[model samples]
Target: MSSLVQIKDVTKTFHRGSEDVPVLSGLNLTVAKGEFLALMGPSGSGKSTLLNLIGGLDRPTKGSVSIGDDRVDQLSERALAAWRARHVGFVFQFYNLMPVLTALRNVELPLLLTHLNKAQRREHAETALKVVGLSHRLKHYPRTLSGGEQQRVGIARAIVTDPTILLCDEPTGDLDRKSGDEILTLLQTLNQEQGKTIIMVTHDPHASARATRTVHLDKGQLSTAQPE
Candidate 1:
């Protein structure tokens, strides 16, 4: 397993008024190609912050973030946006779907940034939906779908572009136990069968158990040992 994502000596700080809030300090991580990794911690533990750094949603205040051969932390804003559009896929806890769009159209949102024609985009979105067992819900709007269905749509949207990495933040946080398990199974299938590299931030141990490896964050630092 070759290294696909690397974070070296990274630190993140937020300035609020006159106070400096340090989130992550001297954090280092390496994610292998096609690895399913879970990040777990209590609130304010910087788990999501680390995921953001890896996904190019945010840059570290210090150190380098590298995915494959690209140094993400060094890229300009425009370049980083382009890079993220091409390589990173994000699935949020809230399932950020446009209310007016159907499931198919929502999944096609990411491809609009590419040169793919309408037909090509539709084909890709359809395939992604099929992968997540949502082919029948393509015409349904977010409001009409169940929590699990909405999350399946979100996953479809994330993988529609065949992104190099998938970043999920509490992907099943809003669902019932059964629904969450279903979503976790979908993620495992994507990892084991489709070979998608996933980095997920989860507070639930059940969610983390589905991952191939788990890392915990506390006070801006990572620990391999799970908390009791």
Candidate 2:
């Protein structure tokens, strides 16, 4: 498969008061098209930072990041936002759904930015919720759903835009074992069946085991590992 993501000698640093704290240094990696990759590391290993950079939520202080044909690291804030909205989908540990909106409306939020009419948006949102197996809960509010259902709603919203890649940060972190397994299974299905390139940050070895490959980050440096 062709490369979907490429990172070359990337580096990122943050300011902590007067100190310059480096998070990632000389990071280099590539994700093949439709690949499922799990990023593993202890706390402060820069796993989240790397995900942010790949998702175009933040820029690297040095080096380059390319997703498909676009130079991700080079885009300005406004341009990156637009690029991300079109190409990248993000899932977090917590389901960040709007409380006031039903699950269907929450999933439709991304489509609102597009020129699609209300019916089209509703159709797309329905399909996405079905993908995540939340079709029956479309009218339910976030507060009324279980942890897994809420996360599924989040996944639905992420996929509703039909992004080129899906970026997940501890996607199963907030769930019980059963729920986590379900989420992992859904993510794996997206990678294997839907052809969505998936990159996820995970600390659970079992969760990492579900990935096609695992990459380890330690103290701002990265090393590749085969998922066992």
Candidate 3:
């Protein structure tokens, strides 16, 4: 498969009260189309930072981040926001669903930025919810749902726009083992059957096992060996 996401000699730094904190140092990575990649590391190893760089939520201090034909590291904030809405879907550890909105409305939130009208948005949201096996919960609010169901709603919201890439940050962290496995299976189906490329950051070995490939991060660099 051809490369869909590429990171070349990327470095990221943050400033804290006259002090510079280096997160990633000359890191390089390539994710192929339809690939399911798991990023594993200890806390503060820059896994989430790397994901942010790829998703255009944050820019690298040096080097490049390329997704498809776009140079993500170079895009302006406005352009990046538009690009993200068009190509990237994000799944967070927390469901991040609004407590007041029904599952369908929460899923429709992202489409509000597009040209799609209310009916079109509803159609897209319904389809996405069905994809995540939540068609029956469309009218349910987040507070009324179980942990796993809420996460499914979150997944529905993420994929409503049919994003080119899914950037998941510990998607299963908040779920029970059974629920996590279910979510992982759903992700696998999306990757294998629908060909959605996914880059997930996970700490659980079980979660990493669900991915097609796993890479480790330490300090600020990448490695193949599992951390001890």
**Model 1 ranges off by over 4 Å:** none
Report how far residue 42 has shifted in candidate 2, in Å.
0.4
The sequence of per-residue lDDT tens digits that candidate 3 reaches over residues 145-228 is: 999999899888888999999999999999999999999999999999999999999999999999999999999899999877
Inter-residue clash pairs, candidate 2: none
Score each candidate by Cα lDDT.
0.96, 0.94, 0.96
* Ten-residue region with minimum lDDT total, candidate 1: 50-59
Candidate 1 vs candidate 2, lDDT winner: 1
Which portions of model 2 miss their true places by more than 4 Å?
A: 225-228
Model 2, span 92-145: residue lDDT tens: 999899999999999999998889999999999999999999989999999999
Which whole-number lDDT from 0 to 100 does residue 177 have in model 3?
98
Error of 1 at 111 (Å): 0.6
lDDT of the structure predicted as candidate 2: 0.94
TM values, all candidates = 0.99, 0.97, 0.99
